[model samples]
Target: MSAYDVARHFADSWGLVFLFGVFLFAVGRALRPSARDEYEHARTVVLRDEEPGK
Candidate 1:
Protein backbone atom coordinates (compact mmCIF):
# COMPACT_ATOMS: atom_id res chain seq x y z
CA MET A 1 0.00 0.00 0.00
CA SER A 2 1.04 3.58 -0.63
CA ALA A 3 1.45 6.37 1.96
CA TYR A 4 -1.99 7.74 1.09
CA ASP A 5 -3.62 4.32 1.63
CA VAL A 6 -1.89 3.90 4.97
CA ALA A 7 -2.94 7.39 6.04
CA ARG A 8 -6.54 6.82 5.03
CA HIS A 9 -6.65 3.47 6.78
CA PHE A 10 -5.39 4.97 10.02
CA ALA A 11 -7.90 7.84 9.80
CA ASP A 12 -10.71 5.32 9.63
CA SER A 13 -9.47 3.19 12.53
CA TRP A 14 -8.29 4.05 16.04
CA GLY A 15 -6.73 7.36 15.07
CA LEU A 16 -10.05 9.18 14.95
CA VAL A 17 -11.17 7.73 18.26
CA PHE A 18 -7.92 8.66 19.94
CA LEU A 19 -8.09 12.20 18.59
CA PHE A 20 -11.72 12.58 19.71
CA GLY A 21 -10.94 11.36 23.21
CA VAL A 22 -7.96 13.72 23.51
CA PHE A 23 -10.07 16.68 22.33
CA LEU A 24 -12.86 15.88 24.82
CA PHE A 25 -10.41 15.44 27.66
CA ALA A 26 -8.79 18.81 26.87
CA VAL A 27 -12.16 20.53 26.87
CA GLY A 28 -13.18 18.82 30.10
CA ARG A 29 -10.00 19.99 31.79
CA ALA A 30 -10.56 23.54 30.59
CA LEU A 31 -14.12 23.51 31.88
CA ARG A 32 -12.89 22.52 35.33
CA PRO A 33 -9.56 24.22 35.89
CA SER A 34 -9.86 23.75 39.66
CA ALA A 35 -9.23 20.04 39.27
CA ARG A 36 -5.65 20.80 38.34
CA ASP A 37 -4.75 23.19 41.20
CA GLU A 38 -3.64 20.39 43.50
CA TYR A 39 -1.03 19.48 40.95
CA GLU A 40 0.28 23.06 41.02
CA HIS A 41 1.37 22.86 44.65
CA ALA A 42 5.11 22.73 45.18
CA ARG A 43 7.06 21.72 48.31
CA THR A 44 10.75 22.35 48.30
CA VAL A 45 13.32 23.57 50.80
CA VAL A 46 16.65 25.15 49.99
CA LEU A 47 19.50 25.30 52.49
CA ARG A 48 22.93 26.89 52.18
CA ASP A 49 25.99 25.76 54.07
CA GLU A 50 27.69 28.48 56.10
CA GLU A 51 30.67 28.75 58.47
CA PRO A 52 29.98 27.58 61.98
CA GLY A 53 27.44 29.82 63.79
CA LYS A 54 28.61 33.36 63.10
Candidate 2:
Protein backbone atom coordinates (compact mmCIF):
# COMPACT_ATOMS: atom_id res chain seq x y z
CA MET A 1 0.00 0.00 0.00
CA SER A 2 1.05 3.56 -0.64
CA ALA A 3 1.94 5.89 2.26
CA TYR A 4 -1.28 7.84 1.95
CA ASP A 5 -3.43 4.70 1.97
CA VAL A 6 -1.71 3.29 5.05
CA ALA A 7 -1.98 6.58 6.88
CA ARG A 8 -5.64 6.87 6.05
CA HIS A 9 -6.36 3.34 7.31
CA PHE A 10 -4.64 4.01 10.62
CA ALA A 11 -6.51 7.24 11.07
CA ASP A 12 -9.83 5.56 10.31
CA SER A 13 -9.28 2.88 12.96
CA TRP A 14 -6.69 3.42 15.71
CA GLY A 15 -7.04 7.18 15.67
CA LEU A 16 -10.70 6.85 16.59
CA VAL A 17 -9.91 4.46 19.44
CA PHE A 18 -7.17 6.75 20.76
CA LEU A 19 -9.48 9.77 20.77
CA PHE A 20 -12.26 7.81 22.47
CA GLY A 21 -9.91 6.64 25.19
CA VAL A 22 -8.85 10.21 25.85
CA PHE A 23 -12.48 11.29 26.07
CA LEU A 24 -13.25 8.57 28.58
CA PHE A 25 -10.23 9.46 30.67
CA ALA A 26 -11.31 13.07 30.88
CA VAL A 27 -14.89 12.16 31.78
CA GLY A 28 -13.78 9.71 34.43
CA ARG A 29 -11.50 12.26 36.03
CA ALA A 30 -14.21 14.88 36.13
CA LEU A 31 -16.81 12.55 37.66
CA ARG A 32 -14.61 10.83 40.17
CA PRO A 33 -15.98 11.21 43.73
CA SER A 34 -12.81 12.63 45.23
CA ALA A 35 -13.15 15.71 43.05
CA ARG A 36 -16.58 16.67 44.36
CA ASP A 37 -15.26 19.07 46.98
CA GLU A 38 -13.07 20.86 44.48
CA TYR A 39 -15.92 21.21 42.01
CA GLU A 40 -18.28 22.49 44.73
CA HIS A 41 -15.73 25.05 45.81
CA ALA A 42 -15.43 26.31 42.27
CA ARG A 43 -19.21 26.43 41.84
CA THR A 44 -19.71 28.69 44.86
CA VAL A 45 -16.52 30.71 44.65
CA VAL A 46 -18.05 33.32 42.37
CA LEU A 47 -20.54 34.37 45.06
CA ARG A 48 -17.95 34.76 47.75
CA ASP A 49 -16.36 38.12 48.43
CA GLU A 50 -12.96 36.70 49.34
CA GLU A 51 -10.75 35.40 46.56
CA PRO A 52 -10.49 31.67 46.11
CA GLY A 53 -7.66 29.84 47.88
CA LYS A 54 -7.52 32.58 50.51
Candidate 3:
Protein backbone atom coordinates (compact mmCIF):
# COMPACT_ATOMS: atom_id res chain seq x y z
CA MET A 1 0.00 0.00 0.00
CA SER A 2 1.04 3.57 -0.74
CA ALA A 3 1.93 5.99 2.08
CA TYR A 4 -1.14 8.08 1.37
CA ASP A 5 -3.45 5.07 1.63
CA VAL A 6 -1.91 3.98 4.92
CA ALA A 7 -2.24 7.46 6.42
CA ARG A 8 -5.83 7.77 5.22
CA HIS A 9 -6.74 4.43 6.78
CA PHE A 10 -5.26 5.39 10.11
CA ALA A 11 -7.02 8.75 10.12
CA ASP A 12 -10.36 7.20 9.27
CA SER A 13 -10.02 4.59 12.05
CA TRP A 14 -9.09 7.14 14.69
CA GLY A 15 -11.81 9.52 13.49
CA LEU A 16 -14.47 6.86 13.97
CA VAL A 17 -13.18 6.18 17.49
CA PHE A 18 -13.28 9.88 18.32
CA LEU A 19 -16.84 10.17 17.03
CA PHE A 20 -17.89 7.14 19.05
CA GLY A 21 -16.48 8.67 22.22
CA VAL A 22 -18.37 11.93 21.63
CA PHE A 23 -21.62 10.04 21.03
CA LEU A 24 -21.23 8.06 24.25
CA PHE A 25 -20.55 11.22 26.24
CA ALA A 26 -23.67 12.88 24.87
CA VAL A 27 -25.83 9.85 25.67
CA GLY A 28 -24.41 9.50 29.19
CA ARG A 29 -25.03 13.17 29.97
CA ALA A 30 -28.61 12.92 28.73
CA LEU A 31 -29.34 9.87 30.92
CA ARG A 32 -27.63 11.16 34.08
CA PRO A 33 -29.39 13.18 36.81
CA SER A 34 -27.76 16.54 37.59
CA ALA A 35 -26.63 18.05 40.85
CA ARG A 36 -29.23 20.81 40.53
CA ASP A 37 -31.96 18.23 41.07
CA GLU A 38 -30.43 17.16 44.39
CA TYR A 39 -30.05 20.73 45.64
CA GLU A 40 -33.65 21.51 44.76
CA HIS A 41 -34.85 18.46 46.71
CA ALA A 42 -32.87 19.26 49.90
CA ARG A 43 -34.86 20.60 52.82
CA THR A 44 -34.21 24.22 53.74
CA VAL A 45 -33.19 25.03 57.33
CA VAL A 46 -32.96 28.45 58.98
CA LEU A 47 -30.11 28.62 61.48
CA ARG A 48 -30.87 32.14 62.75
CA ASP A 49 -34.33 33.63 63.30
CA GLU A 50 -33.05 37.13 64.16
CA GLU A 51 -34.64 40.15 62.48
CA PRO A 52 -32.97 41.32 59.24
CA GLY A 53 -32.59 44.93 60.43
CA LYS A 54 -30.84 43.90 63.65
lDDT of 3 by residue, 1-54 (tens): 999999999989898998999999988866677855654545342455668877
Q: TM-score winner between 1 and 2, please give it.
A: 2
lDDT order, best first, reads: 2, 3, 1
Report the lDDT tens digits of candidate 1 across residue range 1-54.
999999999889989899999999988886687855544442221244556665
lDDT value for candidate 1? 0.74
Q: Please provide TM-scores, in order, for all candidate models, with all chains considered together.
A: 0.46, 0.70, 0.45
lDDT of 2 by residue, 1-54 (tens): 999999999999899999999999999999999999999998997888986678
- Number of the top TM-score candidate: 2
Model 3, position 11, has a per-residue lDDT of 81
Off by over 4 Å in 1: 33-54
Query: For model 2, which pairs clash?
Result: none
CA lDDT of each candidate? Answer: 0.74, 0.95, 0.75
Best candidate per lDDT, number? 2
Q: Cα lDDT for residue 46, model 1? A: 27
